[model samples]
Target: MKIYFDYKVQDYLADESFRRWVLDGGFRNQDSAWSQWLLQNPDYAGEAMKARDIVLATQLTEEPFEEGYFDTIRRETMGAIQVKRRFVRPLWWQAAAAVVLVSGLLGWLVFYQAPSPETEVATQENVPAENVPFFQKNTSSAILPVALPDGSSVLLHPHSELSYHYGPAGTREVQLTGKAFFEVLKDPASPFLVYSGEMVTKVLGTSFTVTAYATDADFSVVVKTGKVAVSAPKEKNEATPGNADNQTTIHLVSNEQLFFNREKAHFKRREINQRDMLQYVPATHYAYAFEDTPVAEVFRQIGKAYGLDIDMEESLFSGCELTTNLTDEPLFEKLSIVCSAVGPGTSFVVEEGRIKVLSKGCNQ
Candidate 1:
């Protein structure tokens, strides 16, 4: 059977949650990895297949593709890489060894390592679910500001999907993919369960963003308020009636982030700042007024919304800093403001769904 994934899902494959899902008993080894990668990278089937072919052809003596070509290819097809720690080592020794190994590999393995043979992801067909009527089901592309039965507000991403059933059950459960931001209404008795990629996040009530785009290179859960418990699929190996895959759970507090990468087969948690949180949050209905916001961020936002390419030659504006308010301007006006920041000679153009920043003057 064959399943198709788009770019959004491909990008999320590097998520820790996705990795956990793959390693969990949910899918057979190859199928699981393939499923995870396909889910995160729907738009990248051809490239993914090519990478998988190369990985399977491991030990081939063909010189690696040109560094730039391979770099670009890796950027488009790569997922996170994680090395399993050796438990026999003492904590301090393990930490030191990890530092040394990671420093040596640096971005090579983390972002661009060649995929292993076993890591090749295969496409699959959905195991059809019976009894769900077509009429009652919502369309996939529907973008709605949904109020969960428990009162939480969710801004669903374009083309992402959610499925839920509500009743007297003690907790509410929902399956999600793509991206969404939740402003959950508190309900301690009815903990909220969000199934994304391979990980499940349980929360009582809080604000958080769950990004599991099938094309994204990573799966990320960022908590902006309250707490969350992140864990692998319920254990199929648990000896007791109640115990399912019960792996260790990572508790995340506000400002904490969790990532699950399927190819890496692990989960990671990190501390994040406000700036990190703001990037994933959906654009506000109104523009933000900035006083001393970094110019780089401004350029970034414009580039994203307008599909503009930024070729910044100088580090000057990256940290040069700025003080400005953008509350009332249109997007183009905002672009104009940023263009003005880097002196008069620089210019910006919007063409064919892309914005290109050209230099009449600045240089590195």
Candidate 2:
């Protein structure tokens, strides 16, 4: 119990005793040990108070999710805590929100923004009988493919869980825990939304992979094709007119990846790794050969083969030609050879995991 004094907010929130204390409304007889410890360690009082609020806000009451989902979340959360115990010490509140968000409990506390006047009127007019949410769990060893009513397909990983409910207007809304690949069917009238923790990914017609296992320190969304939008949950206090619709939104194109660090509440965007992109096109076989091929065409082929977004000044390489037979080389190796072939002093640099071609115009 002494170790709990040093525990972060997430740790306390995950602890059974602490949860009991919170649920019991801090009754002196209910958890005297925790109360006494809080008094003794006044330094941790602020953290403890915040942890209590989070627990109260995110506490599960009626077991809306399946038992298997709960089991998986508990196991992953404990495993992540153990792994994080070594090598890093995190801020109490940050880690607390991270854990709660990963387990999908953040929905109870956050993400319940007030609707606009128009939305509120519509909701009042279209209120239907209480709709039971649909919960799906993949507890088996193999990947489970689920076909949604809206024609979208989800390949849920083992031990992952997804909950979804179609709204009265035919909009598709799903919440996910763990990893899944989604092939969304385009619907101009009804957009698709997937919620994972404190993040929301919206797409009309796109293929993307979201890895959000509860035990992982970070969650990621990788776009394979089409366009997608990712945004963080809006703070309740910051919800204002007009701005509410686009809070912290980031648009992603093909081969882009966005990573959200739970402990830091920070996001890092970059190009997806070439090898990772290759997984999306496993059946495509490319012959890396170019004989007097225009440099632009060569770059296009390379980008297509690897699903990377290679950026350069096309006009600068308008007349440039490259002749090479590249085979079985890693992405950077192939890029290095191509740069050298383009011209002397032509080079490429990787910035934020994206390739930038640096070169003088081809000798006229």
Candidate 3:
């Protein structure tokens, strides 16, 4: 674990144990050494995720990358002269084919690094300082995609209303009167919060669905990925011991759901079945599947459905195809599966609030 203290995204991607944990495809890497290290140093999670994408994209190829092959690729990217090479390992030649796009993949995947503790997200960038406000009502027949000030995203259901503002305190807050699905960007400094009548759902970053209708007696929150905390008024909702504020907060992680009664100010938490998650969200938006679909078309469909921009070099996947049900899995997992299906030397990374696919393309 101490050895990984200085590991960057590229360093982690080049490691075998790190690749093994990512290839395992399980969210909880409880038994992995790196996982234990991460538990001790949580700040490196962003870097870990960036490296995971590179691992998963090129993971299908069992051949090991040449020692410091990426350093060579970086030199090549900078137009370094071709020097006489010595073989440190086998299969480096085959992987070099991916260098064409690895440069872009590396630079674009810097992602959202954790800001210094002293500096916080204003969310009111290029706007009035008076808590830049945005109110959106999805009056259309289809789901509406709304971008928030804090780089978070919302998939508002039809007829749902969303109003949010980021004040001087730096907290990104939203008030919802109806149902909506939120895909929050991870920001530890500033908490992202959603208020629905008497219930409040808070998260540092995660994806979740909240159905809080004013007409209905109950409001529910379903976490799609990551964790969230729900604070609601209970009949005897006294403050917990050591809590300065008189609030009863319920913590929920993946596979957990919360149902809060607005009338009685009571709430119930339960473990949710993955298959039934669609019922909690708008089916038209959450329910999507592709069968025998070309990889390019699949990327476009996912981009359109989730209201995200997926920049891909279509020519690469000309011969690639996929077939799967895109349900329950978080957005990142969906991309991982697609890259794995296209064979090896393929991967995707998030950058500038969108997705970019990097690959060596497919063999004819």
TM-score for each model? 0.37, 0.40, 0.48
lDDT value, residue 306 of candidate 1 = 29
1-364: candidate 3 lDDT, tens digit per residue? 4567688999888787788788886437565676777877788777988898777677454788756668745743342121112112236433542442232222222222223422223321233355545787877776665555455667778779989877467878899999998877667788989998878899987788999878988889998766799997545555465544656689887668898887677779898885787666433243346777899998887776566568999988876766565543345545655664564577776544357888788532
Q: Best TM-score goes to which candidate?
A: 3
Cα error of candidate 2 at position 148, Å = 0.9
The whole-model C-alpha lDDT of candidate 3 against the native structure comes to 0.67
Q: Considering only N, C-alpha and C atoms within 3 Å, which residue pairs clash in candidate 2?
A: none
Poorest 10 consecutive residues by lDDT, candidate 2: 105-114
Q: Looking at candidate 2, what is the lDDT of residue 334?
A: 51
User: Which candidate, 2 or 3, would have the higher lDDT against the true structure?
Assistant: 3
Candidate 3: 10-residue stretch with minimal lDDT: 80-89
lDDT-sorted candidate list, best first: 3, 2, 1
Candidates' C-alpha lDDT: 0.53, 0.65, 0.67
lDDT tens digits, residue span 254-288, model 1: 67888877555467899987677676654433344
Model 3 TM-score relative to the real fold = 0.48
Name the TM-score of candidate 1.
0.37
Question: Which numbered prediction scores highest in lDDT against the true structure?
Answer: 3
lDDT of 2 at 268: 84
Which 10-residue span in candidate 1 carries the lowest summed lDDT?
122-131
